[model samples]
Target: MTTPSRYVRSKTAALITFPFSGGQPRKGVELGPEALLRAELPKQLEQLGWGVQLDRSIDWDSINNLLTSDADINSLKNPRSVSKASEELANAIEKHARAGELPITLGGDHSLGTGSMIGLNRVYPDVATIWVDAHADINTAKTTPSGNLHGCPVSFALGLDGSYVEPFKSWLPNPPIASPNRVVFIGLRDVDEGERKILKEQNIKVFSMHHIDKYGIGKVVEMALDYINNGTSRRDRPIHLSFDVDALDPSVAPSTGTPVRGGLSFREGHYICEAIHETGSVVGMDLVEVNPLLESEAAAQTIAVGCSLIRSTLGKLSRLISGETLLD
Candidate 1:
């Protein structure tokens, strides 16, 4: 029998449900965590022999604060509320990581990435990130056309120029900085103009759809691992996989905040997670942007795929079925 890898350092996992939606202009995205939980995500993880610590008592009232469109950054919507939610999430994630448990964040939206990564980074300073998404999500407040905080998490986490908002900057001033060089992006097809310039200027590594089409998913992943690990064994470096369900083609994951055409295939999406799991270095993961109310017919499909992706990253499929024999 094959032994399970050491992805969860403490043999325990903390499931942090970030049921928040202040990052974007959407209401239904906040329902993602509940939908995923109702789908038996905690039980599924426990089936993989993990000691799951699920957070059932989420104080939405305490975490949320009143906000208006008026902030230091005028175009940025709900700036104070988004910052508050992110700060709270960061503290929760940090608590789990400090205890040596892997953090599995069921995100309310992509905006939660700011807090998730920040919290994980606090524990592991050298953490490498694999940002899997249809959009680069690196836009700053000034560059974001829609002023949605979801589109600007990457900037906030990286301490980019335009992310210095009032409330976010006050508390998360010295964010655990993940060097731009150590981060890699995959499945990006709809990056904004300013984000494109920032990507080039900062030399952030990216494997867009065109690159994926050329190199294939396997080679692309290999390249991503090599780049982030700096040619060291991937197992030696801590990994943070921030997976947005919209990274997959809308046909595969139709219920999301932003559905882009011509995205990663279902297999491609799973392949990314599976490869990362094989390294046994995934310290933190966030599955975000799953809007169950978007596509009625495809809601179940999207939720199932999201759950399966989580399973894939947690070393679920690395084992064979019971009573299976290898004909050697």
Candidate 2:
């Protein structure tokens, strides 16, 4: 049996799948969690000796109705519904995190990260986040051209002015536990122009493709962890890894809603998760933006990659999943 530790020790993971896709224009991303489940994700985690608490699937009937409930908020699409769903997701994740179980939320879309992070902060107020994504996902409602909430999760999580927080005012108390310095980004390649200004203005630390090309993923992970942990032991802080599968090379993970080329290699992506696991401070995680409607074969590959990413975060070895003799 595993001994209780300061970070994670219960050997239990609360698997919460947000299978609704109102954050973007995509229709099939909601099916991502089911696809992952169909791939036996829970069984794979069980093989790693993790006792899984599978939460009930989200009831999307009411959520979908709320999507068109309000007029656009400064050109933002479905602001009301997205905020409601995020608030609900935050509550669900908060319950598991407070219980000391690693809360793993499968994708509805990346926008849900707002809720996931807020919920985690309620439990570990000092939690640090390593946002792995191809796009910045930090565009505010005013700056987003597509008006898709998926592209604006980081802004909402950071409590930016353009985010819809009034609806969640009663629930999300003292939100945005993550400050500019505490959060870092990896694998960013297609950042928007406005987001670039925000990144520079907020002094957000980002390791774009340029940085990755220079430093390598190993060094990048080390730097990211060091920044978040602030030279302290991992046990002294909680780590929240918000992984968007698009962070991987399109060839590596193509079934995502937004696939950017020249992303992390398959091994590099797993390396990020493995390194986080080694810290033993992982409190919660979100695997989002997986859309199976993109292409059947590519979707399957992306789903496999998504599952592999989650397995790595949960302390499973890469070879255990594919027998590939990659470095740890």
Model 2: worst 10 consecutive residues (lDDT sum): 319-328
Candidate 2 matches the true fold with a TM-score of 0.92
Local distance difference test, each candidate: 0.83, 0.82
Question: Across residues 1-328, which tens digit of lDDT does each residue of candidate 2 receive?
Answer: 4512257657888889898788888799989998999989998887776898998645567888887565676677887788888888888988888787888999889989889888888888888888999988998866888888899888878877566455545555555454756679999999899899988888888999888899988988888887777654344468889999999998999888778899999999999999888777788899998899888999999999899898888767734555543422
Model 1 / residue 11 / CA error / Å? 1.8
Output the lDDT of residue 255, model 1.
Answer: 91
Backbone clashes (count) for model 1: 0
TM-score of each: 0.92, 0.92
TM-score of 1: 0.92
Question: Candidate 1 lDDT, tens digit per residue, 1-328?
Answer: 2223353458777888888887887778888988999989888877776788986444567556454443536788878778888888888888888888888889798888888878888888888889999988889877888888899998889888878777788767565384756579999999999999989988999999999999999999998998887765556678899999999999999999889999999999999998998887888999998888886778888999999898888776664334232211
Clashing pairs in 1: none
